[model samples]
Target: MTERGEGSNAALSKYEGYENWKSNIPVMYDWFTNHNLVWPSFSCRFYLQGTDGFVPHTLMITNCDVVKPRVKNAEDISQFNEEEQSPFVQRYKTLIHPGEVNRIRELPQKSTIVATHNNSSNVLLWDLEAQPNRHPVNGAPASRPDLILTGHGNDVEFALAMCPTEPFVLSGGRDNSLVLWSIQDHITSLGSTKGSPKLGPRGVFEGHDAIVEDVQFCPSSAQEFCSVGDDYRLILWDARSGNAPVVKVEKAHDADIHCVDWNAQNENLILTGSADKTVHLLDRRKMFVGGVVLPIHKFEGHKDHIFYEPQWCPDRASVFASAGEDGILNIWDHLKVVGNNNENARAKTRSAPSGLFFRHAGHRYRIVDFHWNPVEPWTLASISHDVDKTGCGVSAVIMLGTTMKMQEQKHGRHLPVYAFDMLRQIWRMSDLLYKPEEDVEEEVEAELIQYN
Candidate 1:
C-alpha cells in the first residue's frame, strides 16, 4: 500500500484530468448480457445464472463475434464507436436448475462448452451451436448439455479443464478424485434437434488426498497434464493410464497447492503457486527417479498464497504473470531472474525468486485471476473479486497493457489508471493491472519499491 502523503507524481500533470474517470472509459458496453464480462481469465464468454424458488435462471452470453478495435489489429484500432458499432453482449438464453455453475471451459477442438458444478458432483457439457430450449422436460434446459458426467464420489466438483486440442474434459472435486471425460462416446442424438456432441467420464485418476483446485492440460500434448490440490501435492498424469500418476511430488508446498500451469513454449516447465505465498518453477523431466526435490526455481514475494495461478507469457518464453488475493499482478522475466549462475542457491530451501519485472497494484482488493492475451503478448486481462469503497465487485474484468502510455491516479502514482492522450483520444486501457515503467515514479520517490 502507498503511503497517504508521501507527495504526488510530477508527471501526473502531463496526462491530466483523471478526475472524470468513468467518462474517460470511452467505449460503450451493454449491461445485461455482459454481466459476467468482468470475470477474470474466463475460458469462455458465457455464464450461467441459477434459479431461486420459482424464478428461472438466465444464461448470459457475450458477443465474441463483435468488433473491439483494441482486440483487433486494424487501422485506427483506438477509435471508439457508438452503440451500434461498439461490441454488445446480451442475455442469450434461459437455464433450468443448472446446480451452481462453477467454471466454463470452451474446448477449442469442437467449440464445446464444459461447465463444472458446485452443488453436485456432475459436470455439464453443451454444444456451442445448440440453441437453448426454455422448457426441457426435467431440470435440463433447451440447450441441455448432451452429457452430464457423474461419478466423483458425490463431491461437488470445482476444478475443471479441457484438453486444448481435443474433446477430452478433466474434473476434480472435494472427493479427492479426478475424472476424465471423453466427448466421442456421449454424442447421442436428440429426439428433434441434432444432439450436440457430449462427453462422459472415461478415466478416473485417483491419488489426491484433498480437494483439487486446479487441473491443466499440457499445451503441446493431448494426453498429459498436471493437477494441484489442497493436499500439497503436484501429480503428473497420462490420459491413457488410470490407476497411478506417472510422477507424484508429495508435500510439494508448505501449504495447499492452489494452482498449477504448464508453460506453453517449454516442454518440461510447469509453474505452481501455493498457500505458502511462494511460486515454484519445476521441470518435469527430472522427477520420480530422484527422491524429494525442490523447485528448479522459486519465487517468494507473493502475500496471498491460498488461490492464484501463474501463467507463462504466451508470446515470450521467459516472461510470466501472477495475480491473487494480494490484488497485485506481478510480471517476471526468467532469463533476467534465473541467470547463468544461480545453481548454488538452488540448494537448501531454494532461496531467491527471479527478480520481478514490475508490479501493478490497481485492484484495491483481492484479485482472483489473470490471463495473458494469446494473440497480444503485451495485453492482459485481470479480474478481481474484491468489494470495498472502490465499489469493485466480483468478476470484474480489467484489460490493459503491460508497458503502455503512462496513466496515473489523482493522489499518487497508480499503475492501475493512467491519463495519457494523443489527439484527445483515450487509448486502450483498463484496470487490467500491469506494472508500467512510469508507474514506479512515485514508488521510487517514496522508497516503496522492493526487488529481490
Candidate 2:
C-alpha cells in the first residue's frame, strides 16, 4: 500500500484503468459472477497505501444490472441523451475495451463495487445503487484493498484485533498508544466532494508506560478492550470511556509484555505473555491484588527468553497453546475451578498433578510465532528462524495433535507424541525428532521414508 499523498494520483490512474478494464474485458464478468446466466454473488475489494499518513485511493463497485451501458461514437458523444448517459455510463464507455462487448452484454444488473486507498487520507464510494458492471478488464488492477486506515505515528508492527461489531479497526504501534478508527465512516465519506472526510480518532486508549505491544478487544463485548505494553502492564478499557483505563493490572510480568488474548468463553479472563519468562492470567473484574486475582497457572519451562506468540484453543476456552525462544512449543490446559468452594484446592489434592500436555522442541533456531488453525483445532502453525551453514531462512511448521489424545495423556508418565514437520522451504521432520540414542530412530526412519 502506498502513502496518502504519494498514492492518490497513482490510485486515480488505477481507478481509470479498472473502468477501462471493466469495459474491455469479456471474461471478467464470467469469472467474477461465475456465468450463472443470471444474478451472482457480489462483494467489494479495498486497496490502501501509506504508513505514517495513509489514505483510501479508490472506492468503486460493480452493480451493472440497474444501470445499462449507453453506446456512443467518439464524435457523436455529445449527441448522446444526457438523461440516459449518466456519469457511470459515460465513464464506463471511456474505460471498457471494444473487443469485450459480448461480455458486457451478459453483465448482471445487481453488482456491487468497493475500493479503498492506502493510509486512509482519501476514500471513494461508488453509487453502485444505480450502476452495474460495464467495465471489461479482468485482473487489470494488480492489487485492490477494501479499506485504507492511516494516522499512525510509527510503523505498525502487528495486527492486534479487528472490531467484532461495527466497521471499525484497532491497531497498536511503536508510538506507545492504541488507536481506534471507524472504517465505515472512512468509506462513506469518500463520496463527499466537499471538505475532507472527518476521519479522526474515535478513541485513544493510553495507559501503557512504554510502547504498546498488543491490543485486543473482548471477543464477547464490543465496548471492552485490553492492551499490553513494554512497561509490563495490562490495562482494560471501555472504548466508550476516555483516555484512562477503567481497570488496570500492573507488573503483569517482570519483563515487557509481548502478546495478550482474551478468553472466548469468559470476557473477564485475560491471558498475557511477557519477556519476564512468565505467562499470567488475570481476571478483568478484579482490578486490584486485594480484589481476588484468579491465578489459573503459569508455565516456566523455557530455558531462553521467550519470543513466540501465545494462542488459546478455539474449541476449549480452558486450553491454550504457546511456543518459546527455547525452540519448544507447548500445549497446556488451564485447570478449571469447578465451583466457588475452594474447588481448585480440592482438585489439586485428588489429581495426579498435570503441568503440560505435549511439548515439541524441534526448531533449528528460535520459534518466532505460532498459530492454531481455526479450521482444525488439533492443528497448529509455527514460524521459526534458521541460521546454519545452509543459510538463514524462515520455516512454517505444522503440528498435528488431537485434543482427545492430549487429554488421555494428561497425567500419564508418557506424553502423547505429536508430529512436527517443515512446510514451505523444505519437507523434513524438525531436528527434535532426531534423537540418536533412542531405538525409536528405526520407527522414525521408516516414517521419513514413507513421507519422502
Candidate 3:
C-alpha cells in the first residue's frame, strides 16, 4: 500500500466522505449555497425568470484558466474549511470568454442565448444580454462572439445541443460528425452587436465511431437527436430522416459514453453517462430487446468516478440528476429504478441503488457541471473541479433546497415549488443516507438569495 500509501488512503476516504456530507447539511438541506470562481467553469446555467426584477435569475458562467490535476495532499489540505475557500458571490457579471469554456449551453428558445465549447471546432454563441463585463484579466481580450457556429471538421469540445423544437443547434466532435444548425435566422443576432456571424451547416451527421461525448435533443424534436461516444455508441439522429443512424445503440456503455440526456417528459426516454461509472436507463422504445442492445436501468452510482453529467427533471418526470468524477451528485427515480417488481421493492433498493434517492456530497472536487433550474423548482446549479491556492481552479455554484416532511405527509397537502420536494427533503431528513449537522445558514440564505 505505498502508492503514496494508496493515495493517502484515498485522500482519507475522501475526507471522511466530506466530513459526513458536511455534517449532514442541516438534516440534508432545506437550502444550500456556494458561489466562488475566478476561473474554472466547465459550465453552469440557469437563466429565465426575469420580469425585469433586477437580477432575477441569471447565471451562465465561464472563465477557465484550464488547470486540472492536483489530487490533494498537504495533509489532505489541512483537513479543509477556510470558509470553504471564500467567494459566496455577492454580485457577479462577467463574460470575456472566447476559449476554454469547454462546454456551455442555453438557448432552449433563448435563455440569454449561449453556446460555447472552446478547445474548438467552432461553437461560440453568447449574448448574455449583449456581452461586455470583461475583467477576467491576465491579458484579457477574448470576448467577441454573438454568433459563430460553423460546422465541425475536427475539435468539437463536448458534444453540444440546443433545440427544444427549433432555433436548432446540435454538435459533436473530433470530426466524428453530427453537426446541425438552424439558429432560426440568427435569433435576432443573439443579442446583437451583429459582428461575429458565421453560421453554416443544416445537416452533416455522419455517425460516430469515436469522440462525440454527449448530445441531446428530441425533447419533442426539432427533428430528433441523440449522441454519445468515444465510440461506445448511442446514435439516434434524424433531421426528418437523412444524414444517418436513426438509431444505432451498439455497446451502449461498457465504458466511454460521457453524458447524454433526452427525456423532457419521456420522448421514449434516454439518458447515458459513462466511462462506466454507470447511469444507464435507455428506452427509445426498448433499444432492441430481443436482438440485444439493452439498458433499461443500470445506474450504479459513481462507483469509482467518471460519469460527468446526466440531467433530466425540467419539472420532474420521474426525476433525474447525476454528476461525477466521484465528487458525487445523484438524484434518481426512474420510477424507482425501473418498473418495481416489488420484492419488497427489491429489498428496499438493495441497500442503496434502488433509484438512488438523493446524494450530493457537496463537491470537494470533480463535479464538472450541473444545472436543473429550468426556472427554479428545487433549484440547482453546480460546478466544481475545485483547486485553490493560486494555481487557480475553482468553479462552484451550488444552491439547493429541500424540506420533505415525508413528502408533505405523503401528499396530504402542499409540495410543488419544485425539484421533487427538495429531493423529498433529502430523503426523509437524511436517513435514506445521513443525519446531524444543523445551521441551515439563515434558512438557506433567505431561500437562496434570489439565485444571486
Candidate 4:
C-alpha cells in the first residue's frame, strides 16, 4: 500500500516485498496449474497467497489460459482490500438442528434446501427464500417446520432427491420404501395461515427387502427413477404407481450397493457406486439379460471404501466424478479411464477393465455425499463425516469455472470481490455470499462486465 505523497518509484522502495511479488504473479500463476489439476476459477489464483509468509491453502487447478489478464493487471486495485480480491471461500454456518444431517442437497433451481438425517423417517425442507424468525416472536413458534415429510414408515430414511423438471421429491428409506412428495401441495399448505391438513406422499413405491441407501430420479423424465439398496438390488419405479417396481434385478452386484445416479444427457445410461469398492456404469435398455443387466463399464480405484453417488458431469456428458468413503474425489472420462489406446480398447473395456482419469484427495474422513453444481458442471459440493481424528463434521461446496473462456479477475478501489460483475454472473448467487453494506457495484461495473 503506497501513500499519496510517494511516487511510483518511491512506493516501490517503500513496499519492496509487494513490488517483488507483484512482478512474479504471472510466472507463479502459470507454474501452479496443469491438465490433471486445473485452476478453473479466478479466485483460485491469489486466494491464500497474498501475505509475505503465504502460500496457497489448497492446490487443485485443472486448466488455465495464458492469454487472460492477471490480478496484477488491474489498473486501480486498492492494496488494503485484500479480503475482497482474494477470498478463497465464503462460508455459511447454520445448523439444521436435531438430525445428524447425513445428506444435504440444493434443488435444481437453487431455490430450496432438503436434508435427510440419521435414524429419522422424516425429511426436512426449507425454502431458500424464506426469512423465518429464528427466535420466538411473541411466543408464537420459534422456527416452525417449513414442511415435514411424514410419508415413510418407522425405519430411518437414507436418501432424498428432487426432480429437476418437476416439483416432486423422491426419498427412499431403511424401511424398504420410496415416497414421492408433491412440492406444490407442501407450499400450498404453508400458505394457508389457518393451517391445512397434514401432508402425505403423493405416491409410495415399495419392493426392496433391505435398507434403501440411495434414490435418484431420471434427469429427463419425472415419472421414472431408480434406487439401490443393501440387498444388492437395483429397482426402477414409476411415480404414478408404487405398488411394485417396474424392474427389479436381484444380486445386482457382488456386495451392497450404496448409491445410484442417472446420466445427464443419455437416459439409457445408469451409474452406481458400491461397497464392493467399484463403480459400474449400466445401460438400462438391456441390463437384464438372463435376469441381470451386466455393467457396460466398471471402474476400480477407490480401493476399500464406498463410493457414494457417482455423478455424470453436467457440462461434459461423457465425463463423470465420484466421492468415496476413502475421502477422495475421482473424475473419470469413460473413453480415457483405461490406459489402452488400441483400436479395440473401447470394445474390450466396454464391459471389463477401466481406471481413473484424475483423482483429488480433498477431505480427511469419510465423504458421505456430494453433488455437481447444476449450473456449472465443473463445480462441485461435498460433505464429510470429519470423524473423531479431525473435527465433528464439515460440508464443502466449490464452484469450478473455465469450461468457457473467462476474463482476467481484477480488484478495484471500492466494493468486495463480488463487486466485480464478471464474478457476480459466474456465481448467480454472489449477492448472498457478500452482503455489502453500501453501494459498490456502480463504481466498478465497466471494467468487470467485459468478462461477463
Most accurate candidate by lDDT? 3
Models 1 onward score TM values of 0.66, 0.52, 0.35, 0.64
lDDT at residue 110 of model 3 (Cα atoms) = 57
Model 1 pairs in collision: 33-90, 38-397, 133-142, 133-143, 398-432, 407-418, 407-419, 408-418
- Whole-model Cα lDDT of every candidate shown, in order: 0.54, 0.43, 0.59, 0.51
Q: Which stretches of candidate 1 lie above 4 Å from their native place?
A: 1-57, 64-97, 133-143, 186-200, 287-290, 341-353, 388-452
Ranking by lDDT: 3, 1, 4, 2
Off by over 4 Å in 4: 1-86, 91-96, 113-118, 133-142, 188-197, 337-355, 383-385, 388-452
Candidate 2 per-residue lDDT, tens place, 181-245, comes to 76554544443334324355677667766777677778756677888877877878887777788
lDDT of 2 at 38: 11
Clash totals in order: 8, 45, 2, 9
Candidate 3 ranges with C-alpha deviation above 4 Å: 1-19, 23-52, 56-93, 96-145, 148-159, 162-179, 182-201, 204-235, 238-245, 248-278, 281-287, 291-293, 300-308, 311-321, 324-360, 363-452
Name every residue pair that clashes in candidate 4.
Answer: 37-61, 37-62, 38-61, 38-62, 38-63, 39-61, 39-62, 287-293, 288-293
TM-score (C-alpha) between model 3 and the true structure: 0.35
lDDT, residue 98, candidate 1: 52
Better TM-score candidate (1, 4): 1
lDDT by residue (tens digit), candidate 3, 1-452: 00000111142234548777766566555445443343344444421111122221223332211011122222332233424322122223555454444556667665557676766789878766677665544555666788888978888876788887678888888888879888888787576654787989888988787778778888776888888887788888777879988888888877677778888876888888776678788888878878888777787866554545688877668778887656677888777646566733674647777777688776766566676644335445565543332332222222222111212222122221111000111112222132212544555566698687
State the local distance difference test value for candidate 1. Answer: 0.54
Q: Compare candidates 1 and 4 on lDDT and give the better one.
A: 1
